[model samples]
Target: MHADILLRGGDIVDGTGAPRRRGDVAITDDRITATGDLSDWTAGRDIDCTGRIVAPGFIDPHVHHDEIVLTDPGMDCMLSQGVTTIINGNCGFSIAPLTATGPLPQPLGMILSNDAPRFATYAAYRDRLRADPPAVNTACLIGHGTLRINEVANLDRPADRDEIAVMARALDAALSEGGIGLSTGPFYPPARASTTGELTEMARVAQAHGKLYVTHMRDEGDRVIEALDETFQIGRDACCGVHVSHHKCAGLANHGLSETTLAMIDRAMQTQDVGLDTTPWTASSTMLNSGRHRQASRVIVADSTPHPEMAGRDLADIAAGWGTDIDTAMERLLPATGIFFIMDEGDVRRILAYEHTIICSDGIARGSHPHPRVWGTFPRVLGHYVRDAGVFDLETAIRRMTSMPADRFGLRDRGRIAEGTYADAVIFDAATIREANDYAHPTRPAEGIDLVFVNGRESWRSGVHSGARAGVVL
Candidate 1:
């Protein structure tokens, strides 16, 4: 007869690929206890939502906040953006669920050092969350490269049978201890040397335990098709599903390749297993020392600190400005600045419209012109592609960011707005919502979010955060 919180007169999308309808939702404790007309329900707190699209809170399937949230739990960047649940451990670069201790991954260098030492294994990371937490709920996958190289320290060649056995043992340990799946980056430094057979061995281990295989495919430029084929082979051999993390083709040769590439996935999904995640923007951002940037035709200096002159210049422009060769300029910025504005807009539209694709933010909190996607990913999808570009219907677009990812990762109780589910929801004006971020000035807050709730408690509303930590790490 009584509810913990009630949202009245909101348009509900539910994230189930269903049509939107006007209704009310009532929460008891942290679960949605009732839906449909509840105008008569008694409640401890009630919020009027007369003009808003109330949908399941966006669940970011791929994220890179391993260190940011540990230090800055505010998550105002994401919270303000309406993200409730974020899945980290993407691209084999998580600080945690490491099977052993050694040099931390390349990404750990940018986030923070204190967080690095704590990530020896999945259990160690989970133990940390049990004690201290972040503002948004996070489910971490085991970074494959972390487990393999952290223990062995180096595996440029295929692992021996015995070495493979050791890594598999450590991987199984992490998965059983609550790792969501296996994340690997064939495009990162430590992961670059990993051979297919070694990855297949780990994939089998994940498949055995019902975990996923998410990969930064071996190559996305000249060898993209080959890399994708290799991924499909691994899934087929391991008998598990595979996800392509931040699927994109970089460099001039790679522009406009998404249609062909997604066609490959569409054909593969008919029988074999494969999927992808992409941001709703043309430019993908990343650390300078990353494999993709190192091999890119040119790693533009989007923004740089300690060198303001080069902040907004591209690689060619930076090279010209500094009176140095492009490679020399790239070498200089690779140490501190991250780059953006590198992918094809045509490809981005093609991938977002793919039926098998989900959306994700492979973001860095510290980048100087970080692709606005970091702050505007989910909101941009709702405002631009769905409402403006007419790429997908409201129901379908939200599903890619919500239920599609939740179901892919086997998260059972959260994505959809349903009775007995955790009431993580968002209320925003569909007509007014839009991303204010751009490559020139990337930190602008999005417009039009009226409210955000995690676990049935208000987190943000009407341009002000409600100062609550309703998030509980999973």
Candidate 2:
């Protein structure tokens, strides 16, 4: 037999949560033509994968890489960690459905930054990606906040009946343009004013199209139970699957509530489709919110818009430097981004070990000192959780990052090492694979990832990106 490429003598995990097996994977063009004993096969290119784990390239189900993909098409940050696919426009933030050429609304702009691209609709945004594809496959969800900012004049109040009708129509149009589903971040100020009826209407639009509904619930702290109930009700009413983004109970007072939240999700799953995503860090980063900041034990300024020099400094230190209280200092650094050290490690591991939980970076890709999870999430799970802590076997961890996300997000022909699947795979040394990035130095890449293939093209090899723009916009 002949093939375009052959990866021989590797221990394959296959991304299915099954036991590993020794096999050879053969590829022709952009698909895996065969996998097994291919000792006699002749190939144009040969890669010796001895003593390595060759598995499906990691899939990040929850990320905010929407705008970063445009400026950095190589996506070296993600590729270095073996993340070949990402779901963007998370947390009810997207760069689409823009009706004019102006600054993004306060909430949406906070994540994407002030310089995000402007598109009249989702189709236009998709077109931009097609023209200059990134090195990773991307699926997008229409942001409910993006829709609200475009249609509703005042975000301080709930949309009226007519406004809701308009947003629904806009959602229908965006879904037609190949958007996978709907995402909402009700915790953000622009979306905080949204009523249950408003969200139900948008979810129904996604349901009518047979898509999913993902949300950053109204609360992840003390009132998380109420938030979970509201989310389940939306799923039930809309008849769609629900995905909770970055699921965790924040604040020291709310510690150890993953027990309660996961139990609620498990019970809800008995009747409805429910899943959650978790980043492998105890700190959360996003646009600075005074309310959330107050609850946090410590805060590090990820980026200070008015004062860029304060990027990596601690919030309390900045306050002392300015001779003001923490609250006053935070107010002066308005429209900034920061990391809230609010979660417990126990809660993080409990959630990651859950069967229905998928791995996501939830990494805000921008800012000077971005959370280390941006560069380290996938490797951290594989090295720290699976290998070091004995949380679960390596295969189980790989399943959460690969097949589980692919299945939940409806990514066709992906997340598996099988015949006819897309040639998206990674080869890494299981013994050495681990995260190197930390809060102080967040942009460093992971180690031990040898080669990464996306759509039959070598995108990264030996810690160096090949500058291949072979990614497809899904």
Candidate 3:
């Protein structure tokens, strides 16, 4: 058969948690036309994948790449790590369908390392993004804060009835604009002011369209259980599926709470609806230069900043140099610094192994020393964790990184190497895969991944792209 592209002689894992099988994948245009023993398949070009694992490129279910460089939002940081599709506006943060001229700090650039990029709203941003967008397939959520900012016209107070109704109308409009669901950061400023009832109202609109709920939750450490319960209640009341982004128990004070957090999530998943995403890292990063996060200083460590020397040091340690307590030091450094080292490895793996679990980088590659997950997450999972430690089989790990995320997040036409799906795929040496980034050395690329194809065209060669543009803005 004539084919546009043919992946020849690879051991295919297919991303289904099933055993690997040998085959060739034939592609025509953007879709996989067929997959079998295709020794006779003829194509204009062929990629020899002998002794490699050809599988669906990963779909990161939760990521903050919505805040990456919009002008170049190719999602390259993630793509370099073998991620082809990404769910953005996670942790209740997304750029979307709204009407406005944009906002302070503009949600896609680094005005402040901790500062989040904001857009006018889903409708407004969608129009702008359609005019010009970065590469990579993107699915988005309507942020709850944007709705409040749209309807309330103020960020310091609760919404009245008329305000709630207006916000509801705006949310409904976003849903009509192809928003996948609702996302909220109960931890962020404008969103933090909203009551549970306010969230319920917004979620109700999303539920009306069969949308999903994604949140940063009210807490990640001491209040994790309560936050999970609150999340459960939101799903229960709104009748929507709820997903927790970047699950962790952060502080040293919150140590050993991984079991508690997982148990709570398990109970919630069993009884109601709850799902979670985890990045492969021992630290967390955020812009907590003020307020509640500042008050909880010991758990927060700044990974980067305007101050050159202090950029990579932990907050508590930095606090000592400044002759201040941890919280006070946070207040002093918060404006310039970003936070990290929030969770350990114990919780990361347990969460990754959950059947309902999906892998995400929560990838934010900013600051002098950005989060390592941005560069090395997927390879590290396959190389270090699976091949090296044997914590999970390569097939099981691939499922979490690929098809599982695609199924749970409502991404259509990608994720699995099935008939008629988009031929966005990867070829990697299973035995040689290795993630090369660490906190101290954050910009190194992953190893063992040899080729990446987007929409059936070769995009990379050992992390160096061959000047291809088959990837598109979703």
lDDT, each prediction = 0.79, 0.90, 0.73
Please list the residue runs of candidate 1 whose C-alpha ends up more than 4 Å from where it truly belongs after superposition: 99-105, 111-115, 290-313
| TM-score computed on alpha carbons, candidate 3 | 0.90
Residue-by-residue lDDT tens digits, candidate 3, 364-465: 665566767778889988988898877789899999988887777677777889789998898899998887877767778888888887877777778786
> What order do you get sorting by TM-score, best first?
2, 1, 3
Candidate 1 residues 1-474, lDDT tens each? 679998899899999999988999999888999989997899999888888888988899888787777777768878888889988888876776554444445555554353345666678777777677776788888887666566555656556788779878888988898888998887766677778888999999999888899998888788899999999999998898899988887767788888788888888898866778888866666655554554454455654545656665677787787899866776777454556455777788888888878988777776555567788888898899999999998899989988998999988798899998998998999998988887677788899998888888888988787888767777
Model 2 residue 346 lDDT score:
96
Clashing pairs in 1: 97-121, 97-122, 98-120
Q: Which model is ahead, 1 or 2, in terms of lDDT?
A: 2
TM-score of each: 0.94, 0.98, 0.90
Model 2: per-residue Cα lDDT over 1-474, one tens digit each: 999999999999999999999999999999999999999999999999999999999999888888889988899889999999999888898878767446766557666766667887899999999998999999899999988888788889999999999989999999999999999989887788999889999999999898889999999998999999999999999888899999999989999999999999999999998988998889998877637787788899988778888988899999999999988998898778889999999999999888888999997777788889989999999999998998899999999989999999899989999999999999999999999988899999999899999988999998899989889998
What's the residue-level lDDT of 26 in candidate 1? 92
Query: Deviation in angstroms for 315 in model 1?
Result: 3.5
List the pairs of residues colliding in candidate 2: none
RMSD of 2: 1.0
The true-versus-predicted C-alpha distance at residue 117 of model 1, in Å, is 4.0
